[model samples]
Target: MGAAAAAAGADPPPSEAAATPAREDQQHYVAAATGGVSGESCDAAAPPAGGGGADDAVEPVVIDASAVAGGAGEEEQGECGFCLFMKGGGCKDEFVAWEKCVEEAEAAGPSVDVVELCQDATAALRKCMDAHAAYYEPILRAERAMAADLESFQTEEAASHSAASALASEEGQR
Candidate 1:
């Protein structure tokens, strides 16, 4: 299903669960990147893990605020203003409506068409956020700038490494 469908809580078609036979306890992490939601850019190279030269690294924006906040027990927030609405920041009532719809759909079982059922709630939430674009636009712009800087830095680093490797090879041949 598409983003709009998923956002609307549409039930997924046929599960590969029977074919793949996933463990019941296995967890899944789904990261959705919707255009104009968080920022304008697509996913970029992740920052190098562990300690690196602070000056050379571009810190990643914390996208999942719930993770940083300690978990579901804590306040859920997101990196962007549009997402903040789901955490009781803005458009909260609309978000709650969507949340409720999804919960109800899920309780109805896998056969139910959650997306079809929740479209109204999803649309309501979407409308609310659209109305508040003035607050989120600048934040999203900043995020896009940061993502661009990160991509540039990664490109430069790759070039630098290639040049250094060439120099090392030349010296070894001498």
Candidate 2:
């Protein structure tokens, strides 16, 4: 018998061949044989299912250093009277006056009286500067500690808000 006749079982119709597993295999083979690109990295195409890009995962923190510094300095000054004075009115005026006095004394070419007056003024200004710093150091430290505490509280509050928002979103999805 011929090969096609034997396979058809004594005059079976040709359409019956398509019902066999071999036909299914051939269909799958033909479907897979179509021309297309292969073996390319998936990252160049769409991301995997349910997986987001890097930026969608975590955001960055942007710190304003100058603004932070200004806030800390203001807090320190508010806590320290000497710091406030130095920032407000005292240091510049005193330094300018001292410079003028020194200039006048030195222009006289170092006479005993001029030298003595200049030395006394210099010592007095140095002592005042030292005393000012000594008086304000504790207050500035206290203000810095308070600012740190406030910053921590704010960070915690923000984190709590983010977590709460995430929980709400998950519940909504359900």
Model 2's TM-score against the true structure: 0.27
> What root-mean-square deviation over C-alphas does model 2 reach?
38.3
lDDT tens string, model 2, 73-148? 4232112112222222223344334545665765666454553655655454444444443322332344455668
* Model 1 residue pairs with clashes: 9-114, 9-115, 10-115
lDDT of 1 by residue, 4-108 (tens): 446433222222221221222011111222233433111211111121122322211223443424555433323332333233224557765776677688779
In candidate 2, what residue range of length 10 has the lowest lDDT sum? 42-51
| Candidate 1 wrong stretches, greater than 4 Å | 1-85, 136-174
TM-scores across all candidates?
A: 0.33, 0.27
Model 2, residue 18: displacement in angstroms? 99
